[model samples]
Target: MAMDEIIPPPEVDLPRETEDSERIIPSPDVEYLPRQTEDTERKLPSPEVDYLSRQNEDILEQKEEHGKTTELERKEKQLKEERHGEEHERPHEELGQGTKLETQCEEHKRLERQCEELERQRRKLERQGEELKRMKTITIVYEQFRQWIEDKASNSSSGVSFIEFNPSEVDDSVPKDQNHCLGRGGYGIVYKAKLRNETVAMKILNESSRQGEREFKQEIAILKRIRHQNLITLRGACSEKFALMYELLPNGTLEDRLINEKQRESFSWEERVRVATSICTALVFLHNAKPNPIAHGDLKPGNILFDDENICKLSDFGISRLLQQTNDTGTPNHITEVPKGSGPYMDPEFKNTGKLTPQSDVFALGIILLQLVTGQSATGLRKHIVDKLEGKKLEKMDTRKQKMILEKLQILDAQLKLDDTSIQDAVKMVSLGLRCSNSERKRRPSLEIEVWPEIESMNKSECLYGSDEVD
Candidate 1:
């Protein structure tokens, strides 16, 4: 402690970069480390020194803790940024993929719908093509028939007249207009036409088979010669197309009237009796022809038609055969290999023997009679009638028809002054029908001898009950 003597500064301990005698130098702008004065070091008490040392240690520990906390906060912020980026990118990718999938689905559905539509159109076109092909074939067939007819007409010199018909006149379009096609059958197709101030049904044969061509020629020949009130009248014919024009029957066929319940309601008992009588009359005329008796090969309800006046007319003589007459007797001989008649109404005897006679026609008439009695199909009626004849109950006959007929008869008895004779005549007629339809050809009754008498008796009863009542 000499007065005015200079003392050197004490050395300050500072952090070093390495332990190998290397002290860290601070930058010129940085403050130097703090150092205690000699007088303060000498005067300071032990407790005070200890307190300052503890304070320094506390400051150092506080600085270290603050640095560690800052580092932790920075790391946490970096992790959050990375997570946020990843979440944002994943949503964008998922959204893009979902959009692509939805677009693909929409496109697929649209294509499927278009494919289905195309398939439907293809099927419709195929059907149309088939129909066109059929028309073309028919047109070609008509042209062939026309040529044959022209040649025959030129050579024969027989007073037979036939009009030339253009095949184009009849087409698919002909069937679409008003009063179009009237009907079609196995032999020919019929169309409704308005011809020269008259409505006529034009029947054109397909002539696809040999049988059909033969029938076309035979029908024309048969219709030209025969003329009767019950027989259908021929208007004209086109030999070229094998088409024949006939008087139009607006009331349709007898089969339609009998089979259709709605039409049957309008057909009264008197009408049925009249129809039967007319058919019998026609058969009688055919069976007893001038030179040779013409056997109508097909006799069924379908062959019978009704005019505008509801008059019954027999038609379709395609399979009619002109029987040969034996020189010894004027009796008609059987025709062998005759074409079979319509099903149900055809005679089984004729089918077995291949012989067509007028008796075969009677068998069909018997079935028609059964149809008038019972509102059931004329087909398979023979079995039902035989069942009834065997003393068994009519299992197949409609019970509803019995009630309807009985009720109708009761009404007729009251209104038309009919008696038990009418009922007896009906029952007798049914009995006659059964005998006429007998499976044994010999057992079956003749249309002229046995059937005519019974039908005339029924007709008499109808007349007695007042024939004017039906008209």
Candidate 2:
């Protein structure tokens, strides 16, 4: 059933190497009958064999192309791996750089902190150095002051006992001592304090004060030996920082009484006349002192003080000097340098000549007298006073003060027998002030010669009208 059905005959047969154009017909009865000749078999190959040869050639060519493609793929994969590795390494390098930058920033901040700490230390040290310098200066001044006092006390003929003062007792650092600062000037600061149940004024020279150390020593030397009722009494002294203690004048300065409305009422015209006279007497005592005559180089209302009793007293001898040598004629011995006095009270002749004399003091005293009567600033009204005395009307003077004094005199007239003497005395005193303040040095009157006696006479005339009575 199987062999005959399984094999099928070819539809067409191909022939090779036949030169004759002949056709061969096969009988269908036998189905498989043809036998190949040797020549034909040699020339023609079988179909399966031919197909296998072609397949082998195609397989060889495909294998060669595939090998070339595989090589290209391997090269591309290698390039990709290299690129990825480069990208990764680049980020790692950047991370390293970032770490280095952060470290640098932290180091800069540390340096800045260290610099600030050093600067603070430097400033603290500078302050400590300044304090040490101040303490050293105080020690030197105190030693000199103490030595001078001992010598003066031992040799003095006045039988005055010099009391040694402790610097710590009057030191401003003492919390119990209330230092109500009164005022400050070139000389130093003055403070009012209640010490030992007694009110007193303490002047303390600052380390940076404009007043010279020599001038402070000079003031101490002068005040320690000199004694006068008209001048301020020196209560005590502290060697530390050039501190001087005096009885407190609750009424403050003459300038204060003149300027302040409430305080000015306490000073009557008769009192001002008496004050001027007493101040002149003080000048006389200073000028005629034993051994060496002293000259008050600076005189102004600011340096004059009033007590609780309203008695005027001279103060601030910071620029006072004992005459180098006294002239026999009562004029203070001339010095080469211009006197150190307030500009308003400075004598013009003294400025021109650069010479200090008793006449210079006289000029300052006259200026003070003019201020007292006119109630105008010595500096501000210098030209006015000059003009008024030179044939100008009395109304042209400070009208406020003129009216005030005249009213006071009129009130006194109603209460007592104030005749022409009071008026004449006032006119004569004003005339004397003008003569004392004359521009020429020779024309200025000495307190001993002219100013003192005239003021004394005026005081005597004023006493008859009850000068002690407050208006």
Candidate 3:
């Protein structure tokens, strides 16, 4: 192609230049050309330079877009790594918390087991202590018995004779019949027998247990030393057979008379009062015995006896206790691990504390008084009388108030056929009975100080005025 065909022609017309406008001057080597006619063959400029310039601008724009895309991809990768790391650590924290909870539960269970073990140990210790106390009591009683037997053997004139008679001779002398059996007790059976050419009551032990032998020895020891009108007299003993001989009382036990309907009718109110007085006299004698005061641990109606004169004689020295002086102050401490007595006649304090005192016998006597006045069984008799007198209050009341209450009270047995004067005496006796049978030991009247005086005064008043006097 021609050079002219490759270049375009310039136009002749140009704009006038102003003062501030830029001026253009033609080069010395350049030539100006006229405009070509339309009919002439015109050459168009080549498009290669403009195309190359547009391609370079497009490449720069593409490079800038690629840099922006790379920055956004880098930020997204960092966020994903941070989220993955957090997810991995979350499980470890949850596992640690779960392990801590399991440890706490195990610790709580261990503490509960330890507490149960401690409670069991405490109960076992209490049982051991009770057993120790029982063993100590047995040892003491055995030593005292050994000393007594030795003294009796060494000194013939010890004021109390313990004769060891032949068992076959005593058995042959006594008759074996139900009629001859005066009474049957837990320890033995009593029979009217001829011993040493004298009519006597013989108690043959049913069993030769240690308890029976001890009771046999204790009875001989006590009865030989004591002699009273209202107490049974021991004649002799058979050691091999565990038999005791006593002066026969033909009237039998007070329990039989109290229970039999015909005998209860014949048992008059004055006789009942006299029986009470006789028992009180016996208790006073036994309680005031010189060496050591004695307490009839079991003083129920079954243990009380009557002679041909119908005088009340206390019996059954099996469970009786001698209040041995443990200290110089004479405060007797006769404590037994196991208490022996009738349930209805047992003193409340003695049952709880297992300590026997003369007041315990007085408690039984109070129950007997209640039985004499009401002719009722000893079971629940005290509560029945107290509830009637106090109207369910049962608290302590003044003497005047109690007397007034007793005057209006109507709890006496109708079978007794008590006259108005006898009823007054019964009321006074009931007052004294309630005072003696108080549940609290301190509230009970002293046998020597208060009980004996009041009973003796009643006996004297009855003898002087014949139940007609109120005071």
Q: Candidate 2: how many backbone clashes?
A: 0
Who wins the TM-score comparison?
Answer: 3
Per-residue lDDT of model 3, residues 1-110, tens digit only: 45556465545565577774565566322542333322233654447766887898888888888888887788788878888887888788888998998898899899
Which pairs clash (backbone N, Cα, C closer than 3 Å) in model 3?
Answer: none
Report the C-alpha displacement of residue 294, candidate 3, in angstroms.
Answer: 0.9
**Each candidate's root-mean-square deviation in Å?**
25.1, 25.1, 16.1
- CA deviation > 4 Å runs, candidate 2: 1-161, 172-179, 194-198, 326-330, 334-338, 392-420, 460-471
On a 0 to 100 scale, what is the lDDT of residue 430 in model 1?
Answer: 69
- Model 2 Cα shift for residue 402 (angstroms): 12
Provide the TM-score for each candidate, comma-separated: 0.56, 0.56, 0.59
How do the residues 71-101 of candidate 2 rate in per-residue lDDT, one tens digit apiece? Answer: 8899889999999999989899999999999
The per-residue C-alpha lDDT of model 3 at residue 380 equals 94
Which TM-score value belongs to model 1? 0.56
Predicted structure 3, TM vs. truth: 0.59
Error of 2 at 284 (Å): 0.9
Model 1, 1-471: lDDT tens per residue? 332453554566755656755555764323321223454456445787799989999999999998898888898999999999999999999999999999999999999999999999999998787655434433332343345457756877422333444655533224556447777787767888755555678887766533566777787777777666678878677666777778787888888977777787777777888899878777777776667788887888888999888889899888888877777654465656755678888888888878777778888888888777665687677676565456522223454553345454331122222255555555656677787888877788756545765676677433322133221
